[model samples]
Target: MVDRPIIFSAAMVRALLAGRKTQTRRLATSPLRRVEVGDRLYVRESMHLWSAGHDAEVTFAADDRSFQTGPNTGDIPDASLTAYFRMVDQSRAKGRRISRPSIHMPRWASRLTLIVEGVKVEPLQSITSRDAISEGIERAGGEWRCYDSSGTGCLGARESFCTLWSSLHEAPGQRWQDNPNVVALSFRVEHGNIDTLYPNLRSARA
Candidate 1:
């Protein structure tokens, strides 16, 4: 029951939060090459975006020299106790680098955890309409002919997903055709903090 950290772009995170995305496809050769039932994935959003909650207040500094973090009513921790930057910085600063960056993200940084329910491997172009909806596409109430822009009606589920994927990975050797096989992992969002998966609580429930 190890906790594996998986970094997701902000768009994908939003889809997950909205329950529109339940499956993700990965290159067969990537670190996430294989998955099994019961594996848990800790989903981390982009490190750059910081959003405010209903009770949380955000303030910007007039001068670029200083900044305010939050509006917590509780006592604040001493600034001297913490070093602000990420751990990876130290290695990069010394001219060294970590090869597999995704696996190195700290567990505490992940806000959501999902339990894998199924796994499969197939060609990249095998997405079905049902699966496309699972991948977060809304039915445009007709097929969009990519060649013409005459407001050709709705795009099919597969074509819609292709558009989304192409937007994210547009580089020449990284397009859809370049990826022959993909490992698809289907998961369900867990109800609480990811911490529950690392301990005796899961065993107790079992």
Candidate 2:
């Protein structure tokens, strides 16, 4: 019954939101190795925030939308939108937008939570087709497929999973062919701020 932070790309976040993703595999690093069944993982995605004192608003890159913090209006007001853009403009003037990296996102701003249901340690390439599908491969025209980092689609769940994994892990010993040991996590996505749904469990640890 521990809570930890996990980072996901915008595409994976969308898949989780759509109920298409249920499993994830990460290198059996010290941090991931600590995860266990019954643990809660708060997702960290790319986002930006505009705040003034206790007032704050968050815009997620996943869907390019804004959400008001602690409130009724799901959409930011015209005035606030203006200010948000103005802030963005200021950032652009220096050469970038206000987008924050997923790794740096605070837990309080996370919008997706995953409840771990199972955990296993296995070789990265040992992922079965069924498990690959659970990793968020999509079916189109009756073919299970998934896109690599370059957006090229690989046909078949296992094939697609291999491509996806290779694209993300190119280190000498972490690539697909390396057959590195990985922590495979099976989880159910819970859509909401983690703290909002499990205030009592927020401080829990394994």
For candidate 2, give the lDDT of residue 51.
Answer: 53
lDDT of 1 by residue, 1-206 (tens): 44456667655666677788899887677666645688777775433212233122111111112122333422112231132123334434554432223334344334468888888888778878788778765544455322123344445777777766676666665577676677888889863336534544332111
Clashes found in each candidate (C-alpha, N, C closer than 3 A):
2, 0
Give the per-residue Cα lDDT of candidate 1 at 78: 29
Over the stretch 1-206, how does candidate 2's per-residue lDDT look in tens digits? 78888988887888898898999999998487899888899999999866554345678999977766533333333323454455545554665436689998766667888999999999988899999989986765656555564555566789888877876788899998899999999999998877777755555633
Q: Which stretches of candidate 1 lie over 4 Å from their true place?
A: 47-105, 139-154, 171-173, 201-206
The residue ranges of model 2 lying beyond 4 angstroms of the native Cα positions read 52-55, 70-97, 140-142, 149-152, 204-206
Q: Let me know the TM-score candidate 2 reaches against the reference structure.
A: 0.80
Model 1, residue 26: distance off in Å is 0.7
lDDT of 2: 0.77
The alpha-carbon RMSD values of the candidates against the true structure, listed in the order shown, are 9.0, 5.9
Per-model lDDT: 0.55, 0.77
Q: Any residue pairs clashing in model 2, and if so which?
A: none
Q: Following a full C-alpha superposition, what root-mean-square deviation does model 2 have from the true structure?
A: 5.9
lDDT of 2 at 109: 67
